[model samples]
Target: MLKFEKVSLTFKTEGREQHVLKDLSYTFETGRITAITGVSGIGKTTILNLAAGLLETSEGSVINTFAKTAYVFQEPRLLPWKTALENVTCVCGDEKKAKFYLDILLPEGSDKYPDELSGGMQQRVSIARAMAYDAELVLLDEALKGLDMQTKDAVVKTLREHLKGRTAIMITHDKSELEFCDTVLEISDAPISELKHVNR
Candidate 1:
């Protein structure tokens, strides 16, 4: 389980203090998929970073109990020198498990390097790497942004299967993605003050 107790995050930019989160309190239950949707630059990704312990809160506290967490960023963030299969295997050190996810996400490009694959294909490889890791919590930041509709549907289905019985949070601009999640959090305002649960 992950809990944010009046968490606040502030960044210093060019001698100005920018507050991203302000006295925000929320709980992400265990073994559930939560989808976060909001306008651009509203600090949705910052929440994920805080959950993953990649960023520290300026005030308050973040309580995360999950032993392992995997994050798929907006970019593929793959190694240019490693093949798709290698990238996936690098996390879990299991080629068989890596191949299994790659076969589902990037079947044809498993042997290809990051530079050789298209943007969508590279993103798929990145997703496969996270899936292969089998972490207790998964964080996705616009993970399906560039895929075609058909491909996006297929990848979402695959993710749904892999994410079962795990805690997952994703930030997406697409409304259709909300239907697959157990909970949808809609955030607004420049400095996010609250997270509202959107009724499905």
Candidate 2:
């Protein structure tokens, strides 16, 4: 399981220190999907970044016992120079798994480059890369923010199948789009709190 114990982050935006997260304490169960949803400025991304170890907490601790992990962002963040296959294969495999995901997520001719793929296709490639990373834990931060309804459903279905038994924590505000999670969490100005859960 992954956990956050009294974790808080304070940053100096202009000059004074500002508190972003406030003593967040959360626990993620093994082989379960947890969705974190909140308003725009309620520090939703901050909590995911803290859980991802991308940012350090100012107080208390953020704990992760899992070994391998992968994170997907709102943007594809793919290397413009690399081919679609090269990006996914950069993890720890040959071309087989990369092509497998391309077959699953991409269109007929999206293996070319970032410049050639559409915005939705690029996001699919990003999801494919995250799947190809072969991690036990996956962090998704508003990954479907800009995709249209059709693209969102397709990618969400594919990603849900990919996360079959792995632990996943997703940061998103679209509650209707979170059918993939068994638990839901929402962050407020007070602290991180659990909003919903399903029996294991």
Candidate 3:
């Protein structure tokens, strides 16, 4: 299980401190998919970074027990010089597994570089990379922003199958994506309460 205990996050920009999360506490249960939802710029991505240990919280602690982890950023974040298959294989070092995921997510562009694919195709490659990493905990930040409904359904189905017994936390504005989640969390402002959790 991954946990955030009384965590507070603040960032400094131009000598000014910005408080993103204040005394927040939440738990992402094991073997469940959680969707973090809110209006744009409500510090949703900050929570993911905090959980992933990519950023430090100003106070309290984050507890993670998972051995392997994967993260898919809002941007594709693929190496511009690498092909789609290479991006996934580079992480897991399993060419066959990478090919399997790419076949599901990017069947048409396995050999294509990031620069050679469209924005949506590149995003799919990133998704395939994360899925093929075989991580117990997967963190996705706006990971499905650019795909159409058919592709989104395919990718979501692939993710569901790949994440059967693992944990996934996604930051997204799309409500339809909640169908794949067992829980939903919405950040609430005005007095700054912890995230509102709903079980599906």
Instruction: Give the alpha carbon lDDT tens digit for every residue of 1-200 in model 3.
Output: 89989988888999998888888888888999889888887788888887788898789898988998899999999998889999999988999999999998998999999999999999999999998888999999989999988899998888889888899998888888888888898887822349898665
**Which lDDT tens digits does candidate 1 get at residues 2-34?**
999999899999999999999999999789999
Q: What is candidate 3's TM-score against the reference?
A: 0.95
Instruction: Provide the TM-score for each candidate, comma-separated.
Output: 0.97, 0.90, 0.95
Q: Report lDDT (CA) for all predictions.
A: 0.92, 0.79, 0.87
Superior candidate under TM-score, 2 versus 3: 3
lDDT, model 2: 0.79
For model 1, what is the alpha-carbon lDDT of residue 21? 94
**Clashes, model 1:** 0
Residue lDDT tens for model 2, 1-200: 68888877888988987777666677788898888776787677777687778898888898888888888887899999888888888764769988888888876644689889888778888888889887899999887877789878888888889899999989888877677788886555434433334343
CA lDDT for candidate 1: 0.92
- Clash pairs (backbone) in predicted model 1: none
Candidate 2 residue 32 C-alpha distance from true site, Å: 0.8
Worst 10 residues of 1 by lDDT: 188-197
